[model samples]
Target chain A: MVTISCRDLDVDLGGRRVLSAIDLDFAAGALVGVIGPNGAGKSTLARAMLNLVPTAGGSVAIDGAELVGLAPSHVARRVAYLPQGQEIHWPLSVERLVGLGRLPHLAPFSRIGPVDQAAIESAMAQTGTLPLRERIATELSGGERARVMLARALATEAPALIVDEPLASLDPGHQIEVMALLAARARAGGLVLVILHDLAAAARYCDRLVLLHHGRVVGDGAAGDVLSDAALDAVYGISAWRGEAEGAPLFVPLRRRD
Target chain B: MSLLLPLLLMFALLSGLLSIAVGPAHIGLPAMVAAIEGKGDPIVRAILLDLRLPRAILGLVVGAMLGAGGAALQGYLRNPLAEPAILGISSTAALGAVIAIYFKLADTYSWLVPLFAVIGAVLALIPLLALSARGESALTLILAGVALSTLAGAGISLALNLAPNPFAAMEITSWLLGSLEDRSFKDVLIAAPCVAIGLALLLGQGRALDALSLGEDGARSLGTDLRRTRLQMLAGIAIGVGGAVAVSGAIGFVGLIVPHLVRPLTDRSPSAVLLPSAVAGALLLTTADIAVRLVPTAMPLKLGVLTALVGVPFFVRHLLRERRLW
Candidate 1:
């Protein structure tokens, strides 16, 4: 089991505070969704957890080990990160792209061996991208590309998975597939944290929701407990209906009263 | 057959042997080999050992350096079009050599030529690197490289025009054209160490180059330190091209062509491209140098001219395809 704890974490970007003093804990076997409006530091928080961005103040620890003390490859082994706007300038096959995830695990100067191949195959199978492995990743449709990228992350076999806006380009069917994959991973005792713009999707699939506004966490708890009308209005300046369908939490944004 | 490596090696050996033997005089292979082994007639021994052997070896080294240098540049910039010439490193080094030669600085102190050339190559790299980093895009880096090439070309042309005498002017022009002609053991001795150091640096950074292809920000997010990689690339380029241009007078196209030729052999991975490019480069230049000697012409053509002559067609073909894989 893994636990990620961020204590009073602050990040400064372009002379502006992008993430204020924030504290949160993500335990293994939980799906935590970060929901916020644009520029609410969702991506920043994910990046900070990966140590992609420099931390301005406070600390982050993964399973009681300080994130700062870990090397990148070591961090990569424990915590896999999928950035929102990943792009490859060159055309590479999906398999090759996914195989890159095994980099942190392999020894320097070592070629990809049978163990890596097995992991890649398992990852492709898990994400249902096995048939598309030979195709060029850039040539795939948007939803297919998203799955391939997730497969790449899964190839790492990391305990803690952090995804930034993973649902952005996914279609409805693929969206559920991805969310189901994350939920499956969480049920299998992995920590799944995702930043999502779709409140309804977040409410439906996520076990807990963390709301952010202006670089600070506004609310954190079970989805139903946190997605209150007042909190939604204060954070997003809009009221959202909270309900349930088929035993899944559901949210619907309401227009201001005429 | 994917046996290009063995084929290239065979051709390089054949060229090296043929070059030492079939000079202006008809010294046969047996005689040349005997001479090089220090057991032939005095005249043949002098000709082979004192002259032809160094020239052939220098060609081999310069070619290897250019090939390896080109591969590294392409890998670092993630631009297939990047070459020693395209990036202006060769021109800058050529200019440094010319200045040293024309001012009689090399005559006074033999080490000055390569020293100045290396410095000039490093100097040229600074602006290119700086310009590329401003916008943090690979396209901007290529543009900056082109701009440096233009400026460095103008500097070389102006230097040639301002030469003190006809002999200096001729030497300068020939150096600009780039050749392995009349190079002695001394020149070979001066170039070998630098080229070796450069190749070592490039080959060592092979995996790092693979990481870099994902872009600097991506690599950093994956835990690579960008500043360190950039410095290592700079040091590699300076040593490789600096040594090559010092000996061969700015041979072009080898750096550009060798990578493309070897990329397929290495399954298109940037890390796999490094050493294979070096080997392919050595073979190509050695064959071209031999071709120059064997073509039955009054004057042996410059090695640079031979490479450009061969490279232009392939370059055009790549351009027509519009793949930018080269």
Candidate 2:
């Protein structure tokens, strides 16, 4: 099983403290949602964990080895990251865009082999983007572009996947489909951490939740426990109506606390 | 894309042969073939081997350098408008060559002009790249390039103003206007190594450029060493463009125009566009050089002037079409 742990991590960007004294552990076989209000350092935390951003203090480790010491390609083989924005500069075809994920696995001059091709095909299939394989990526709909980006990340086939705001431009159907896909990946023995803004989706889909406020973790536990009215009101500054729907937790934010 | 490479190569080869054959001292195919095989008249052999061959070769090399360099810069910067001359690399190189001319260093040593030009190109690149390394946008880079180009243009004017004699000033003026006229094999020898090295460096970066298409964050997560990629790209442009300017002065627009024309044909892959753009660049410049020979002006037309005449309109059209980019 794969595990990622951060100990008292601190990050400062442009002389501003973005994340401070944060500690967390992520394990395979679970879908964890990182939900927080704007500027709560959710993206910073993810970037810091991946070593994409410099940490001011403390350490992040993957399987007991410090992440900072690992080669970037080695780190890439273990963790896949999907950034928030869906920016595709060139109008590359979907297949070509998705094929870029195999870069870390192949040599610079090497052509895609059988295993790489299979992984790319499988990732596209999982994201339901195989039908759009021949279409231009930049010309796709917002939701389709998001799916293509997700497929690019999934094509990495890394043990752990960290996705930031994957549902931002996706429709309701795509949102549910993507959520289910993440849950299934976790169930299949991969660690999946998703940053989400939709409280209801987080409550229904994630096995666990990590709630942030002022760059600190205010809540971390099972979804139902972390989505308590008090925790929600304090961290998110909103009072939420919480209940169960078909044995699944449901959360609805009704009013601002102030 | 598969067919485009061969077609471009064939076009470059045909254009190069046509350029050699179309010069003032025209030699037919039979004589040209005999000249190559060392059985032609001494005058015919000298005209083909000593005069036209180097000019044609320089045209091809210089064009290839500008085109490939422009494509690589565009790919690296993620902006379609990026080109060597616009980025101030070529002007800085010209400034170096002009300074050499002013000091009579070029008169004494044929190689010093290109060497100093390469140095100047590399120096200009340092500031431009430093701005980009700070994560500046494309607009900032273009603005910086414009500033550098303006400053270099002034420096060239100053050199002209301070020229020791009228003849010296005229020589510097015409050189600044840019030309491939009267160049010899010595000029080709000077530029070939630098161009070869620069092309190698840039072409090796295809995979990295592809990764960079996803933006810096995406590229980093995909295991692309962006710092290294940026360094290689800057160095490649400096050496390649500096060498070309060292020999042929500042031939503009080939870099900017050829890549845009060939990009769609290459499936829009930045890596895929490099070789074909190089070929297209060679073809365009050689054809332009032939146009220079045929234009029948009182004095020979400047290669750089012809390119600017063609390129400036294309650039204006691009800006008007992509007005939203600004």
Report the Cα interface RMSD of each model, rounded to 1 decimal: 2.8, 2.5
- Give the Å shift of residue A114 in candidate 2: 2.8
The top-ranked prediction according to TM-score is 2
Model 1 Cα lDDT, one tens digit per residue, B267-299: 565777888788788888888887787777676
Error of 1 at A46 (Å): 2.1
What fraction of the correct interface contacts does each predicted structure contain? 0.18, 0.61
lDDT for residue B220 in candidate 2, whole number 0-100: 83
- Reference-based TM-score, model 1: 0.89
Candidate 2 per-residue lDDT, tens place, A1-258, comes to 779999999999999998999999999999999999999999999998888898999999998899999988888889999998977888789999999899889887897899999999999999999999999898898999999999999999999999999999888999999999999999999999999999999999999999988889999999888988788777877898888889998888899976
> How do the residues A43-87 of candidate 1 rate in per-residue lDDT, one tens digit apiece?
899988887778999999988889989877778788887777766
**Residue B3 shift from truth in candidate 1, angstroms:** 4.8
Kindly provide the TM-score obtained by chain B of candidate 1 when compared with the true chain B: 0.88
TM-score, first chain, each model: 0.96, 0.98
